[model samples]
Target: MGGTDDNSNVRSVKMVFVTVGTTCFDALVEAVDTQEVKEELLKKGYTHLLIQMGRGSYFPKKSAGGSGCLAVNYFTFSSSIADNLKSASLVISHAGSGSIFETLRLGKPLIVVVNEDLMDNHQSELAEELAERKHLFCAYPQTLRSTIVIMNVDALLPYPPADAKPVAKLINRFLGFPDD
Candidate 1:
């Protein structure tokens, strides 16, 4: 990690979370487990890698090979979702709507790693649309290293307000502050 050490009292080492959702995404996890990916992430100052693998056949090499910095969870439910998102500075997840909305709602930098194997190629379109809108970035296992190298939290733009003018006006009117 290229950040200030804990003893230095400067910046804290960050956490990167990867989730494969309910189904297996062995390929994505495996790619992220490669030595090249590991070294790049470490150099980027991410001290911890938290992976939620679900039923995936492969576990992260870093954790399996006895590196204390990487943690892998084989399964998780919605109860675990919020804490996981809140703890991570960046989230790399299967391109599912639940994870996408949740990550965006939390304003976390997200990388939507599309699993073309599982979704009958449906995730590709969704990933493309989201990426086009600048809501997130997407990558396949083969390009994982380069994508992570270019990962930028600053590239995320502000989300538009959820309520339209009429909706806001309705709420205010209901509160007896109408037509102001």
Candidate 2:
């Protein structure tokens, strides 16, 4: 409940960017909007929480303003999220291949939250594999709070750029094709 405009003491703002891509993942949107989550993020030294809600029916009731030290804001969509991704210290994204690779290519620490409601949940397969390699952490909506509590950003390995052979090999491996 403490709100202030003075950020002079803050050297550089660390933002936690959450994107759900082009689909609705309300569970994700709602999960990060909670007071408990915000407090946890603040404890981790993050100053902002920005959510790209995409086509979700649920919008967080929280206002787009600074709540204590953490400024929470969200939007429905954007033409290009590259700038947002670039600015983030950490990214919590839906388990979409595009989102996954882009954030990884930026060499940012990422946590991919799998939406378990989808019928053909390929997201889990990709997220789990990436997590297994320690490139990023994977979580479900139910486990996300706990994941945030325990996440050590320094422990994540940088994901190789897409043009790199390792990425090609990873994709091939994910698709069940023999490494060539």
Which numbered prediction scores highest in lDDT against the true structure? 2
**RMSD list, candidates in order:** 8.9, 5.3
* lDDT per model vs. reference: 0.72, 0.87
Off by over 4 Å in 2: 1-8, 63-67, 162-180
Model 2 agreement with the true structure over 121-158: per-residue lDDT tens digits = 87799899989989999999988989999999899988
Kindly report which residue pairs in candidate 2 clash with one another. Answer: none
Candidate 1: pairs in clash: none
TM-scores, all candidates, are 0.75, 0.84
Off by over 4 Å in 1: 1-6, 9-11, 62-79, 161-180
Please, what are the lDDT tens digits per residue for candidate 1 over residues 1-180?
A: 797676654346477888877878888889877778877777677766778888877755445222334443334334466888899988888876667767877888888888867636756666777788787888998888998898776887644437234544554465456565
**Model 1 per-residue lDDT at 149:** 93
Q: Lowest-lDDT window of 10 residues in candidate 2?
A: 60-69
lDDT value for candidate 2? Answer: 0.87
